[model samples]
Target chain A: MSLVFAGACSHAPGITGRSERADPKLREEFYRNLGRIRECLEAARPDALIVVAAEHFANFFMDNMPAYCMGMSDEYEGPIEDEEWLAIKRRKIPGNPDLSKRIICDVMQKIDLAYAEEWKFDHGIMVPLHFLTPRYDLPVVPVNINCQGPPLSPLHRAYELGRTLRAACDAQPERIALLGTGGMSHWPCTPDSGKINVPWDKAFLDSFIHNRREDLISYTDEEIFADAGQGGFEIRTFLTVAGATEGSTGELLFYAPIPVYAVGCTVATMAVE
Target chain B: MSLYCIQKLLYQLNRDPYTRQRYHDNFESLLEEYELTKEELGAIREGDIGLLYVMGVNGQILMHYSALIGQEWDEYIHAMKEGVKSHGPVRAGIYTLLKGSES
Candidate 1:
């Protein structure tokens, strides 16, 4: 099986940007779990990592948002925000256009896909990379679901995307790992930025960790916004992972609501047989 | 939609260093490109984070702009709250004031 690993983690910029502001104990625990992800990801020894992220306005915007996009550049650079502000230095990351094209072509057979030869790394990507591949050594295939804009892609489509991605990864000779990174339930950038719906998040994670397709994709946007805040829409990332790892249950490596980080941060991996 | 234009301006400013430079060096010229409302123009000109927040700028874009303008994290959050108080709840967009979160 070329699909060696599949996991998800939170990619809140505050996880790195406002690091010191969060409670030390909670913050360390979160970091430690992220480190655990790094360990597991390294143990898989993937040739390329596909990060299915719900990016902010950093790249795709309302002007022309794509429901799904994959990076197709041989090289990309990022932390598009001020390096000092994001607390991650801007550096070029390697990409494998050949691998991307093969995956994109396969996904296109089952899904309408958008390919970008040019992609800049925003916190949605950089934050995860900072922990999972701190050296920037692995060739990355970046995927984004427009979680920021309204009228998002349907939940079923997101799940289908995971299934499609799995087929594509299985076709490849290189060992591939998938990491879906996003927030749980927290109000970021609003006045209620620190508010977190712990119960709602735990419920969602329960559905996700168990790979319960119906429960994972059953959430209505209105309900997510009302209960989990708009940020909760990012569950699409987790949903995608669930879609890819269907029939295989998952393990929750870590989960906590660190208010300053503006997310019920999560780290977990789905078993891939 | 003037809000779209307003957001477009901030989006360009936040994403592109060239646009950021143009905004810093010849803001009027750069501002001319976007069809903004007088209030939006005034808000941008004054770096009124509160007013901009109240006008319904997406927090993701606005957050980077806040950092660009050198507002600390707490100050940025405060500005959004202050915006709710001064200009009323967010005029539009998905980022509502979260009921009683209005400070």
Candidate 2:
């Protein structure tokens, strides 16, 4: 099997255990969920991982923000912007530039989508990765989806992008695991910013767990942002991941509306059959 | 004025050490670069979050500014709430408190 595994999780700074010391129960549950996902990754044993995550202006800003960008460098630098907050030791994650270049070439030739290279890993990629590849040994291809600022790509478009990613992975020789990271729902920095929509978050987790693709794709970006909160835009990453695992089933390993981090945290894995 | 202008500056301030150094060296000179009103400048100078909120600054921008000034996360959230009461309704941006007026 080319695409051996698929998983998604939220990446908040608080999850780093640096600043927001989450309650014992919350921390335990979060760690347990993370451990469970790590177990799956270990079992899948993919040669390389293609990680899709949202960027918080860590690499790109308004001056030059790409709707989607891929890293094709041999060595990808980790997060440096929020070292104290994220608590991730500064280092370079091993990169699989050849695989990244292969996917880039495939997308550019097949779908006419051009992606920039040389981007670094932000907290979005590094935080979840700390659990997935604690040794920092897995070769990674980082793809950044812009969900931070306005003028976001449509949810359908993100799903389409995920499909494109699947096609690229299928074309490759090595086994690959796709990890889409970010959001269940929690607006960051807004007035009612930290407020969690438990019902909405639960509905999202249920949809993923049951593989309700139609229901998940039905909600437009506007609806998500309005009801779920602005940062809910990050859920677009999950939609993209779901697109990759078409016709596959998934299970929600864990989900919690963690107020400490102001994110409706969740972890789910999909079959890559 | 423009929430974009407010946010852009804050974004830069949060990320750019050089700009942050510039801000610390001379707040007015840095303020002059952006199209901010006197009220906005005053709020920024005094770290007057309530005025900034009332003047239509976005929460995304306001939160970082609060942190830069050393306001704890809870205090930062409370400041925005207090801003609504002390300064009146939110004038603009997405966080413009409508009914609850607390956000």
Candidate 3:
């Protein structure tokens, strides 16, 4: 079975770019966090990475929206800058369809969950990729959740999905790593922007790293929504990490709140027993 | 009213009241601008923010209506697309709704 190290991440744009004009302090923190993540990846050396993140209108729409989608593609793309980020293209990655199929089948049969195919990667997947594997050489299997839409998966459901994903990864012979990317706090583009709920965000980061599944699971949607603000759409990433590290413990690697992008960026490593 | 309609209505409530009044008054013209139908209008009149949100009405339309009815458009778009890139053509309705509406 492959190892799954998962944790929450921030997807704010300013943090992802390498412009020298950015805030020096925030940029310093970003690089610091990036270095830490690199250490984790080197240690894990996963043959394949299963990334779970939220979709930002990247693939689905009103015409045909899927509550959950999985990328079965051989390659994925990062964010674009040449064409104003809109022209950014996806690179091909090796997808384990057999594993993907197994995961899909098991989740459906066991949990009454269904997912759409042909999923694409967005910033939720890209930010971590840029930070963790900037070279774009690693193979990744992408899973996306429709956090913006109603009928969001219950937190418990997401946890269960993670557990199932862990099982699926175990079923595969190759070693794997799972990365969950999103936020801790801060709203995008509002008067109260850049505000960080330090205490609450820290609590979440602590619980996530310590593998406080029961406590994390106990949180109500309203509670998370209240804490995360609109950007709280990121909590889904935590749920993904939780699922990947089923019954294991997590270690807090780093946590920093970047006021520039209004995100409480954090990273953690999960060691499944 | 359907859940969709109720959600849209709530979204209207979240907008400026003057904009809501103008929407109530010139419902047809505004609906036409958005390519909305009577059913959709009925949905909005009933305060279906989710439906309106799902229907892809530009928040700017709300701002325009707010301006017409002498209300403030103090809100701003955060420019979230600043650093992100797209892998392909993203769907429109949901993106449009999310782009135009306030959180």
**Which of the numbered candidates is closest to the native, going by highest lDDT?**
1
lDDT of 2 at B34: 97
Best by DockQ: 1
Every candidate's lDDT = 0.91, 0.79, 0.59
Indicate the fraction of true inter-chain contacts that candidate 3 also forms.
0.03
Q: Tell me the deviation in Å of residue A84 in model 3.
A: 3.7
The pairs that clash in candidate 2 are none
Give one digit per residue, the lDDT tens place, for model 2 in B1-103. Answer: 4676776788788767899999999977898899976766677788987777777665555666787898876787778778888978777655432324344
Per-candidate Cα RMSD to the true structure, in Å, reads: 2.3, 3.2, 10.3
Instruction: Please report, as a residue range, the 10-residue window in candidate 2 chain A with the lowest summed lDDT.
Output: A109-118
Please state the CAPRI-style docking class of candidate 2. acceptable
Off by over 4 Å in 2: A17-20, A109-114, B53-61, B88-90, B94-103
Model 2: DockQ score: 0.34
lDDT of 1 by residue, A30-109 (tens): 89998999999999999999999988898888999999999999998998888877799999999999999999999999
TM-score per prediction, in order, is: 0.97, 0.89, 0.70
| Candidate with maximal TM-score | 1
DockQ-wise, the better of 1 and 3 is: 1
Deviation from native of the Cα of residue A212 in model 3, angstroms: 1.6
Model 2 lDDT tens row, A52-161: 99878767766667787888878887774456656788788888888889899886664445465566677789898898999999899888788876677777778878
How close to the true structure is residue A254 of candidate 3, measured as C-alpha lDDT?
66
